[model samples]
Target: MVDADQTFVIVGGGLAGAKAAETLRAEGFTGRVILICDERDHPYERPALSKGYLLGKEERDSLFVHEPAWYARHDIELHLGQTVAAIDRAARTVRFGEDGTVVRYDKLLLATGAEPRRLDVPGTDLAGVHHLRRLTHAERLRGVLAALGRDNGHLVVAGAGWIGLEVAAAAREYGAEVTVVEPAPTPLHGVLGPELGELFTELHREHGVRLHFGVRLTEIVGQDGAVLAARTDDGEEHPAHSVLVAIGAAPRTALAEAAGLELADPAHGGGIAVDERLRTSDPDIHAAGDVASFPHALFGTRLRVEHWANALNGGPAAARAMLGRDVVHDRVPYFFTDQYDLGMEYSGWAPPGSYDEVVIRGDAGRREFIAFWVRQGRVLAGMNVNVWDVTDTVQRLIRSRAQVDTEALADPHVPLDSLVP
Candidate 1:
């Protein structure tokens, strides 16, 4: 029999929620664990959706984070296709959709995650304009890709972020002419910084993907209920048969906000406020993944990190905390993106206006390089492009908070581990 007192309710069936449930069970909580997901399907991996999955390189079954039989064997009650209408913090209950069923919980984890930001421009609602976030979105894009004739189709992608670049690469692989429009001066400028962003721009260009930087899109033009082109702020129209809006993502925190949970400052966008323990204002409720903005031990500020590592790690951390374990979330932020034939891995935390020097290792021209961000002679962040082993060295350097010799770090002759203190 399940322990009634250990009933844990998890909202949202993404990586965070599913992992949290798994962690709870692994921690010997043989209790009632209920996972509520608004989506009809079981929790699945999302990172591949924008890359291999979109290109039809991977099957839908491979995207699942956990198999149905696994959940059943673990005794996890999955409530799929059920919307959480509201959360009653005081009563420790969650109300669902029109059915008005209320489920009470001793502890609750809100892994609501985030939704892809959509283009609000004209013709955005047209048939060929889409945003890549969910399985449904990928299915639609796959359908469109399959229906295209042998002639190369024009695909206009809004925003030059990782998703946009990945989709562009996939589209190009399918013999489609891809155009990426970004208001920023360079692709991934907001995340990768200018020098690295320039490298990414070159990589995309090398793949025959047209990139329009420092250009704001004014509207998405469609004809006869199908997207035809995207109009820029410069009064230029780029013809396109399909448009993928991969601008960014917004945290899904409406239910959390309505439940009277304190939210993060809007100046930092719509992320939910949480402590180092991933506990929200209400002690009974906790949050993880993209929806959460928690204090960074290294950066000395709060941040909302939207990365696969964060979702995978943060979920279990929150679950452990909910199970009366006192644990501080202090992992250095890490993420990676694959574009064309290049793979980029980044590690550590970089506080704004703090890095004093950036040391590059290996040759950028040869499609292999690692850049280290240093502040006060201490390594703060590192980016490795096409060099997988650099990630191991970077992780250790970040954890040790070591000061690296710039000369050794910048020298291609020296191995990355030699720079680690």
Candidate 2:
């Protein structure tokens, strides 16, 4: 039984850490809870930063996970704008803040999350260069988008991933010209493969966004400390008043590394290696969210997911395991994206080469369809675009691992639930 004498410390103030703290209290744990965050703001969700909030459709206050007063009411020690300098595993203590104040813990949860990958090319430090990973970045970008639209300025975006595409859509809505540069043949080539990635290319092109496929931004050219244009490897220069780097993120695991915790292989996307219970090699410590790489029994591979759904669910699962409850962090990978008029939700993992074929069930041109990635007649992953209320059925099909007929899977008349058997 967890007693009041025990103190649980949580590092990193992202969604995962915030939810873990909430779960501990809801589970009737009387122990002391300390939540430490390097950011001054309360724990908030990141999806809004790229989607609604960035587009000005959502207010700033909506980003927070909970009301500011909730932490105080729950007797949780909320330390904002503080950093954990080091973790002394043997002493069960963490040296935090600039003063090096030490705080001991019976159990510790690291939800350090990930940081945006930086652009290494010259002129990246120019006035209009931007990267969106935090609320502050979103706030600045939000204003920049409006100003660009008013001035009819051009915005060059690097990468055509979710962040890049979403921001491209937002920039277009703001009436700013957009030029996206990607090394892949199509947008989202890594996640959706060439087939589905082509659809995104058409979507953005229809919205008046220029896409430079099969090329990368070699350098961001600038004049007078302000962005002037983005030079591509093809010897083409796309005029730009601003540049947004959306190349993806790297998991933050420095603390876990310094503490001597076992880490996952780099080939598998380096992260703190954890078991089914989200517990690290050191039994007293656990890692969740983007920082954790756990073996997925269903997929039969160790995976690290940076999606919002993982953090939303993983935190609670980690907390349950901390309370000595039977828990397995084997939830299927899931993610969603909103770009222009198209909205999509993808469940299960079927990165390129994992599936032998993609079975589509609706009109592709209309942008209302369900695509399933199947291998050996078993569904490996599924994505529904502009389709609603079918996520549960799709996930059930993935978990069942049952042989599904490609003909029936692609038939709109065939109900998805009936194919499970």
Candidate 3:
């Protein structure tokens, strides 16, 4: 049972934190709802940082989850640009910054998000070296793209993950010659597998983005305190006017660790360990978004997803759980990306090499297709690229767990729904 008078304090005013507050208000928890965020701006979508925002296709005003007035209307006490310095779990209070401002709370929600993983190579701290994780980074990079005047500037991108690739695409769109470096045999090999990774490789190649796999960066060469080039172990030197490091991210778990909350094993990527209900080891505490590692019903394994949809969906689910509502916060893992003319939507998670076969409908060469991963004739995961209005059918195919006929699924003529039902 939830006490209406108990104060609810939410840390990290990102998507998850904002959504959790929205859920609390919607669920009739009228007590004081305090939202704390280190960023100066309101909670906004992150995907735009690499796509529309970076490319100048969208305005910053449209990125916010809600305008400043909305939080005031909901009576949510919004604290921005304030870092939580300490959490006194025993006293049920949190300390803010150097001022030692303490706030008492009956219940706490940890939505602390992830931050960009820094490159360990030498000269990484030099000027012209950048990483994109927050709105500020994107805004800075937008100016860098403007500086790189089209067709004359060279930008070197480190890593080939979704963020790296999207930033590369945006840079190239701005007329910079972009080069992507990946140490793996193929980009995104760990997540999407080499087959699809190579498809993306082709997409980048067609867009005039040079890709180098199976190579590691030795050092970032700088001239006069500014990055000028990067050298690789493979004896290749990339002359870059600007360098963007997109090498993954690490979960912001310092708060959870300091408070002695149980965390996922280091081998499991290290996040706050939570049950399906999003409750931490302490029932009075809850977690959501990238920081929380919960059991995945569809994946049948403990999974931590760092996607927009995960934060959007998991926040509300955790809020309900915090309110003592009986809820199983399990949903299919879903993510999407846009690169050049290719728009990709992927639903479900099957461990790499676990899927028995991949059935394709439509043409991969033409940049339009739906790829389905099957295990023992049952659909495990599906990806629809440049094919709109089919995610519902694909998600149903995965949740239903009904065996599918590969022949009909691969046939473009057969409707996806027909095979599932």
Candidate 4:
């Protein structure tokens, strides 16, 4: 049982922490909910940082998870721009800042998310080189992209992940020449497979975004601390005034590691390890979102998902688990992305080689389709691309895991619900 008079400290002010606080209150915990964030802004959606927000289609204030008044109204304390220096699990307290202003908690939640992986190459510190993870990074890159547009400049993008591709689309929309350098044979080959990646390849090529597949980036050449071009290992150089690195992100597990939390095996993409309930080794401490790698009950392996939906869903589950409820974070992993005019929503877990076949519905040539990964006739994963009002159906198909007829699954005339059984 938790003491009603005690405080509940939540580290990291991202969506997971904010949602956990909301869950604690909604579930009638009524204890002190203190959320600590290193960033100055209130909790906001990070996806917009590379997409709608970067393109200026969404306002800065609109990105916040809740308004300033909402936190006060909910009786949640927001410690903006405050760094949590250390955690004393034995003492049930967290120390912050150089002064080490210690805050003791009856229960603690670690929602510290992932950070962008940086490049080790020379000229990475150049003025025009950028990485997008936070709002400030997007703000700076937005300005740089706009400047490039006005000057009819070029921006070199290293890596072809979602962020890189989305930003490439935004930069193209801003009328700047864009080139994406990828070490993989196909962009997003690991996740989308070669077929879907080839479709994306066509999409970018159609939009005049130059893509260099199977190319290794050697370095970013700069003039007077400003980017001039990106040199490839193959000795090819793409001229540019700005460079954006979007390789990938590494989970921010320093605090968890320092505090002696059990970490996942490094071979499994090292992260703070937690059970299905999102409870860390310490009974009073919980972890959620990107930093916590919990065993995916469906996939039979631990996964740390760096997606908004995971954070949003995992938070409430962790909150419930913290409140002495038997909770399993068993929700299907879902993530959505908007690049150019194409919007995509994917659900379920499909480990590499787990699926025997991909059954795609609709016209792939037209860029409107739903792709499903089937293993032993059961739907393992599904993705709806440029499809309307079908994500719920896709999720249902995945969760139900009913042996679906590949023909019916691929039939446009057949409603998705009809194939559910």
Q: After superposition, how far is residue 160 of candidate 2 from its true place, in Å?
A: 0.7
Clashes of each: 0, 0, 0, 0
Best by TM-score: 2
lDDT string for model 3 (1-421, tens) is 5666789999999999999999999999988899999999999989899999999999999899989999999999999999899888889998998588999998899999999898888989888899998899999999998778564888999999999899888888888888999998787777788778889999999999999999877789988997789888899999898899988888899998999999997666679999999999988889999999998777777888889999999989988888888988788889999989889999988657879888889999897999988899999889999999999899999999898889999999988889877
Q: For residue 285, what is the lDDT in candidate 2?
A: 96
Worst 10 residues of 1 by lDDT: 143-152
lDDT of each: 0.86, 0.94, 0.89, 0.89
Q: Work out the TM-score per prediction.
A: 0.96, 0.99, 0.98, 0.97
lDDT of 4 by residue, 113-227 (tens): 9998998898899888899999889999899889989999999999998899999999999999999999998887777777678878988888999999999778999888878
In model 3, state the lDDT of residue 261.
96
Candidate 4, clashing residue pairs?
Answer: none
What is the C-alpha lDDT profile of model 2 across 1-421, one tens digit per residue?
A: 6999999999999999999999999999999999999999999999989899999999989999999999999998999999999999999999985788999999999999999899889999998999999999999999999999999999999999999999999999999999999988999898899889999999999999999988878899888999998999899999999999999889999999989999999888889999999999999999999999999999999999999999999999999998899998999899999988899999999889998999999999899999999999999999999999999999999999999889999999999989976
Model 3, residue 345: C-alpha shift (Å): 0.5
Candidate 1 regions off by >4 Å?
1-4, 146-149
Best-to-worst order by TM-score is 2, 3, 4, 1
The C-alpha RMSD in Å for every predicted model, in order, reads: 1.8, 0.8, 1.2, 1.2
Model 3 lDDT, residue 204, Cα = 92
